[model samples]
Target chain A: MIGWTRRNAGDQSNSEAVIQLTNVDYTYQAGSPFAATALHDINIRIRKGTLVGIAGGTGSGKSTLLQLLNGLLLPTGGAVKVLDHTLLPNMQKPRLNALRRRIGLSFQFPEQHLFEDTVEKDLMFGPMNFGSSRKEAQSKAVEALKSMGLDEALLKRHPLTLSGGQMRKVAIASVLAAGPEIVMLDEPTATLDSAARRELIALLARLCREEGRTILMVTHRIEELMEVADEWIVMHEGRAVFQGDADELADRSEELDHWGVAVPEQLRCWAEWTARLPQLAALPLPRTAEDMARRIEEAVHGFEKCESTNIASKEGSQQESAQELNDQADSSMDAPYRHEKEVSACVTS
Target chain B: MRDKLIIGRMIPTGSRVHGLDPRSKITAMLLFTAALILSNGWPQLAALTILSILVLTATKIPAKTYLRALRPLRWLMLFVFLFQLIAGAGNGTVNLAAADPLLWSGTWGPFTLTSAVLSSALLAVSRMALLIVFTAMLTFTTTPSMLSRGVEGMLKPLSRKGTGAERFSLMMRLALRFIPALLEEAQTILKAQAARGADYEEMKLKEKARLLLSLLVPVTVGAFRRAEELTTSLEARGYRIGAPRTAYRQLIWRSADTWFTLLFALLPVGALLMRLTV
Candidate 1:
């Protein structure tokens, strides 16, 4: 076990862990009638400036883990250290307030928290509470709204008047106004249309890439985060079952699917194709459509050499088999070509 | 139908009353209730009534909305008025002497209205109305969470005695939030029962009582399940009962709160002096 731990610790010098859960165990009130253990002996570390995706089924304790990051819930049996604050079962009031200011949490279906009359006041609530002046808070609200790709005209409008997608953005902008170093969201894209979901993911990606903020989001849809997330954490029945880089996750796609999380269909198809062509399997698995296209081009070139070898070895029977293999390749190429063209259009236009 | 409840509806006006620290509002409410109790005559009651109405108007919520809020109490108000009119007692009546020319007209019954009973009933109804309107004003402007926090803040000075005030308020807020959701669930259960040969509206009184009792079992079981899930979610978010934490929305006392307090305080004292002089 020690050797495996040492072997796994490779090239972690550039990144620093922002949240560390050390042997954390939590059980609901023990003497109560409905008492049950929610999490047990959990240890995980989330690094700074990375988008970490946590995937789990219902009642798998994914929600329980997110609460521990901001000291919203305490561990019953162990310790949780978030940044500079160490949270024990008994925490002082002052320390808890300090911890909350450093971490911004957006609860599930966050639009419920929009209780202010106008978008500006709702966004300003957090910053003002944390001791920002009126002017500074208003500026932060504007900045946060802009980050969500919302218009300045929305500031005076009631939050309830906005459309569903806009309401979700304003809810997020309220959290951003607090200016926390780390932002955690619970199912941010749940119930959104595909276009809105894509825009939200892109916005989160920018926060991590451009603003240098650490983001930890819980998502049942693992495929949604495939292109943007740098790290993957899989939870099952209150345990951190797997934690590693995105590439490491690609190899464990089958295990993930069995755990009730759907891996992207594109990745699965590419994996199956690579399995039949052993020479192509040597290359790294691609995370996006463009990456898949480049890999396929290389694979087709490799296939030409194999075809030539087969023709040289068996000149008599090569024509019929070669034609059939070519036909299969042609069909596969056609679908991917159209997909690439659509993606490029989206990117450019 | 469930959405019509005035308890958790937060009107997002940024008026001074809306922004005043919840602790101040709670204190002011107690003080206002005490003054209403001390008020005796028309002069004092009129002052208190006018003050409440002015505050209500200043909230800038629609007049129609305020009247609509009173709709729930309409039946109860009529009951009180009818009870007062019929059941009231008065002084003894005097019969006229027909032979004496100097004798005037006689009072036939003791049922005639008198200052004592009439004044008491009128004052009681006015006090009740004032209390409801003022309390509604507080809830109308503030979120349920803020109200709970305000209650917690007011109780903070005594928290050393293990009251768990903050946790209790948090529970109240959660309960208020889930009331509508629970009512919807109960309605669905009622509909399901009706679909399966249980006609609640057509049933006799005894049968209706039995059917309602049967509905309680499922509703209670559903409520417990929800409470369990809510507890887990809250606990996971680092909520500790009895642990002190800084408020996200701090209540600060402004000049308006102080001025409002002074104005209410002077009314009862001035009324007492006026009654003594008269």
Candidate 2:
């Protein structure tokens, strides 16, 4: 328990690299007839305590990259450094189970791996394996499940009997019970509905913001992750083509469509918003719907303030102009992606 | 490791054997099995070996594949050979012309050893090897779905005895379909556990046992879940037990089928004659 807790204390160092990869090359089934190089000369640097979203299309080597993060697959060339452990290609890997215990990887469709009948045993499994006492493991399991927003009463029930979403959460909770500092998830919200996806994202954000666990979530649903991810890493054909903060991402997001990732809808809406109304263009880019609404609220407030000043100057001719201005603002803000007339009119309105 | 196995694998080649009706292939396999069981001595064994080699060569698949099928069972074959050699040595006969000549007399801790048993052991090992190779040939030639359909057609007559033969074939088809799916799933589970600090390659026996328990339960659950979904889909498609149905891809029998099956048809009769007279 002490090692598990203290092991991640290094991950809390904000500026240092939690994961550093240098010229890594991975070929699946190397030396076999089917040997195909999945990754070649991949170099990446993930800073400590950042919730980073990894975006890519299918067969872009996103899952293969996650496997390399925790030494599940050794590099065929170059080096990988995570925390204090450094993995060199073709070198006899020094005991890596210690490194694994500190980095909890929640794979895609993880619930399908839950073999234990009872949820309690499944959650406690990781902790127990890493040498926690039964009592200590039980507490850790409870703590992990609670953090995942699961009811503690469900711990004694069979994991198989749980709903698909619940089983997925419990499967992740089982990994978290080991209490690794760096958590990497591969498309964690892949199969969930929109609302469930939001909840899962919020939970992951909480793990980063409050719990101080660095997360690298690989996903195809880039728009969903756009709101919460502190930064993004875009991969294309087994290469990290882009890595930057959300503002830089929004700036370069138009080109993401060429790489097979749709420009997140919010970014599209923001582009339309800024291109028409040049006044608020300098403001920080908003990713979520709420963020967009807040930005629009500012625009509306600015218009109202300007309208009030105009109304004071032209007192007798004010009422009719105010009504028209309100109509113009509503039409422009509502259909943000619509024609240029409403977008340009709203700024003057 | 499982991927290296060549058993129950179909190699696609439009050869004389591969293009035959699956029922003809199935019949040939049955006849071959009977011949293997009834053949008693050297001449019949030689006929079976020649027949196996000819049928295998007709498939155009590499001979190495048939050998690869036997690779996994090599250890078991050796153990069986040793057991046979030990058990037959109690006859109290010795043939020690050459050095050793598979002969060693006197009690060595457990039992007595003599000479003549080595001949019998070689025969038994050869018979076992032939049986495995012949079965491997049948699997290599026929695709699983076609094989299942052939078995269903062959077993159709048993439905008259109320033994539910088509159900057995259906069960077999389902099993054949799911084996690869299950293997893939089990691999994923193994990786998931490894990511959670269950070091399978380095764990002690007790820890390995625990890892197996973790693997087995999820796989069982996944199977049931898959079965439930399959049942629903089948029912939705109007599948019914013991209902009238027509073949979508009807089996076409040709002269080449009869020509191939005729060779196998002679062996079983020849074997029965040998069994009775020899």
Candidate 3:
């Protein structure tokens, strides 16, 4: 069924767990009256060589969770372990610096970390800071630029001179130059156009597949991550409300919406179509467009016998009244009350 | 909105000025300032003023754009001019007796409204204007990272004395990068508060201070949180501060830099010679 179990089971062993957050709880400082809990009882284990998607609405503590993953932030109540180094609350400064080198993090915006004169120097900044030789760093910078689909000629141009999408790629490549095993990006495609967003996703997916790097990406667009994600973790109001495979997400689609997440349109359409067909109601939920199409075809065939019998019965009765009832049912599907009833019936029965 | 913030940002136009190393530009600007300060006669000031205007014209940035850079400092410039004109200890003499009678009537203790004081104020304003324009030209041509690295390179010789020059340069770069982000965040927070009927701007002075005080808690907290996340992301990418590493864009000196250095050095030398000869 291409569910969570199947995906996780298919992944190779010995990939190593790169990040382990065990029962992590985080709270903001208490001086302010508005100080609130940011994260609660979060336990997540990310394996190496997988692209993990973290999906959550605004103020769901997604940013807080990402910081904890790389030891940038300490858990107020629990432990966070990244690449053999563990960080508890109030760790000493020297230990934190030691943990930073193995993790490459790209902040949300392209401009925040870009301060170099030329694209080349900015890309080399991280590698150089980590004690890489000048020649090796320059080579790594060129490779990073190529990986981001930027031209070698751009090496001498100022980063601010690049177009919006190009600047974003440069910013990302700067991190990639450092070659961190675990790469975490926060809303990397937030402001990019569709083509740029697609290119970024493809590049990140390839990075995980070709290089076997562990990628943890936090995105608001759940549908965009559908094809690439190995695991989908959904957060709601400071808690990990759901964590499992992509297909498992379909089962919790209703819960996701109630928690203020915009459910993927494909899943919503599948749920609607399933509600109108009595025979299709028994089939398992589908997560993607292909799965939904296949399920719909299977249901159509299962209803073929009953549809033929119903057609024969309608032919014998008042055809006008039968046709009128069918039209009314189709139109009623568009109504909010009817839609809720159908979804509730699908859920309960 | 984003474009407004990016308007005056340093664009790499590949102009001769942009190609020069930032350290050379910094040194030249320092010398240029010294020449302005050392000038005691009108001829020396005129030479310094003409030199600054020539450099400003060479930048190729539009006149309107350069003027816009002065908008932020306009009030401060006005304040300096007014303060010097009104408060200067001047000789008690009616130097402008042939001028308007209304100007002669206004007297503040021993200070009289005279052409000498007015000319001095004008000279000061002109000098300040030239300084700002020159400094803006430097920033407009060079990117922040190059400027920081240039500063770091300049301080390399002092590193043997156990100074954290590289660290300071890094902090400067980080600060420049964070300013816009922090401003945007503050705007968002302010909007959110206003949406909740906080009306911070409409409040009384004491109330506004209280509101501003309340914001510091969240803003500082948010800043620290962002710093934490940024640091983690940076560390995950194998960034190590204070580690020895090679540079991708190596700073090189060119003929243009040498010319600019010579011009900067000549200005002060000319001013000093004029002072001695006079």
Candidate 4:
């Protein structure tokens, strides 16, 4: 609810705003009989160098939001501001090649768009379009390939001949070859396996952390992004229902189910521990299972120590201390709820 | 460009035209095309145009969709009009003396721009537009599967022994089915390329051609991949070609279909009467 009522995201200072949308509305084939409104009154501000996850279900307008950000589709009603350029309704759309070169958008199943005979030429396509010299683009292509954890020798092979995971990585490398300042992907790890998805996300996190490139990734499975995302935007029925840091998302985790987003097990476990020990609420929400387990153990032990000290001062008896120990065991048994078991299993795995 | 393509797009409005049998609709389309081609003079063409607009309106689809179908062929229609004007080959059909007065017949100019030739050129373009609109109406009112069934039913007599009709019908069905999907895939690829800095809309004509050539490879490859997958799925379901599969949707030809087709049957007769009298 904190981000829901913050309709005035445009009031923020411009220094940190890399992308901003104020009262934006987009309709597919607007003014036609088959026209559909994909987004409505969307107001958001994405700061520079942050990895944001856009979570939504099918037909929730996640893809439309990415297209609007990259100038692939102009907002039919309101303004779309990306980088230094501003787009308004009915204005002459100026050439966006310069703007597009800095804001790379990789569509869902981007590998299907790869057409070049060789992987190296496919990777170089973006940089060459942005007016880079052939030699510069070639080196950039190699850099992108290496960054994607791909072999340099694979560059000479046809893109279609590669494995599905490798083709997806090569496709992503093609988008990164231009060295964009902002990268937006629509379900980049959609069909990838768990290990491949982890590797791709880790690579994207490194891109944001090391190269200072802002990344916006669209995904329905928020669990995969819980550990990496700095911020979250939950969309429902074309409206951004929630937009905030992980703590706010945790606070409103119950509302996520209503928005068609599943609450990750880690968040549920964190909630259980915070409810049991109110003292844990003072700390930041844990993003990983190991962090959650450590915080829960430390808080539970500290609470037990305080209880034992109180019991010793009030009634100095062996029987009451034994009772206190039994009570502690009972609480610990109760603390490992289903969510905790799942999170602990995640940790062990 | 994706939005402009109205072919293979069916808008269901539950109108009378939408309820008629696809066989009747297809028959009407054939009859309508015959009438359109047979009509030569201004009065007959005007009648056919009015009839086409009436039939199109009966489908309850927006006129803008029909017009959008013609948008892709505007240049080709213009070429047809110019070719007709320059050729001016209507001398055998219409008596020039009875036609409109000649504007120029000077000795220095072997070619002449007369009112008759101009009207004939305009008529030719109108015919082309009507043909496109009528075909669009067929697709707009009927889904691809229904149209395929209708085709199979119509060609059943031709293939009394073999599976030729069913095979041809299935091929037509698949081609019809893939038109919209292929267009959608093409649009996705186009957007993906645009995102990677090859903005098709901003490119010059030559660059646009080159970009389209690049897209052709991916689109064809994607089509082949899709076809292979579809083949696997069909085979997994034990779908053998011409395996005497029973119809899931039996097309019932009601009296409404008869009435609907009769309306179109009148057009060719009216055109023939006009031709004889003229």
Q: Choose the strongest candidate by DockQ.
A: 4
| lDDT of model number 3 | 0.70
Candidate 2, which segments miss by more than 4 Å at Cα?
Answer: A1-14, A20-43, A58-60, A71-95, A160-164, A233-263, A271-285, A293-341, A344-349, B4-6, B13-16, B40-64, B89-116, B157-165, B242-248, B270-278
Candidate 1 lDDT over residue span A3-76, tens digit each: 00111235544678889888988776443222578888888888787778988888888877877776656788
After superposition, candidate 1 runs with Cα above 4 Å error: A1-13, A92-94, A309-349, B1-278
Q: What are the per-model DockQ values?
A: 0.02, 0.47, 0.01, 0.79
Per-residue alpha-carbon lDDT of model 3 for A25-115, expressed as tens digits? Answer: 9886432222478999998888888888998899999988877765555688888888988888776632443345567777677444455
In order, what is each prediction's RMSD in angstroms? 24.3, 6.6, 22.0, 6.2
Question: Which 10-residue span in candidate 2 chain A carries the lowest summed lDDT?
Answer: A1-10
Stretches of model 3 off by over 4 angstroms after superposition? A1-15, A30-34, A277-288, A305-349, B1-278
2 versus 4: better DockQ goes to? 4
Q: For candidate 1, lDDT tens digit of each residue in B1-278?
A: 34344544667667766776676677778878877766655667788878887887778776656665666777777676556655553321111112113322234386554444445455566667777778888788888887888787777687768867776787788887788778856654553333222335546698687667546755775678789999999889998876667776667778877777777677667766765675
Clashes of 1: 6
TM-score of the second chain in candidate 1: 0.79
Per-residue C-alpha lDDT of model 3 across residues B112-178, encoded as one tens digit per residue: 6565567666667777887887787888889888888888888888885544887788788888778
lDDT (C-alpha) at residue B187 in model 2 = 75
* DockQ of candidate 2 compared with the true complex: 0.47
Docking class of 1: incorrect
Among all windows of 10 consecutive residues in model 3 chain A, the one with the lowest summed lDDT is: A329-338
TM-score of chain B of each: 0.79, 0.86, 0.82, 0.90
Backbone clashes counted, model 3: 8
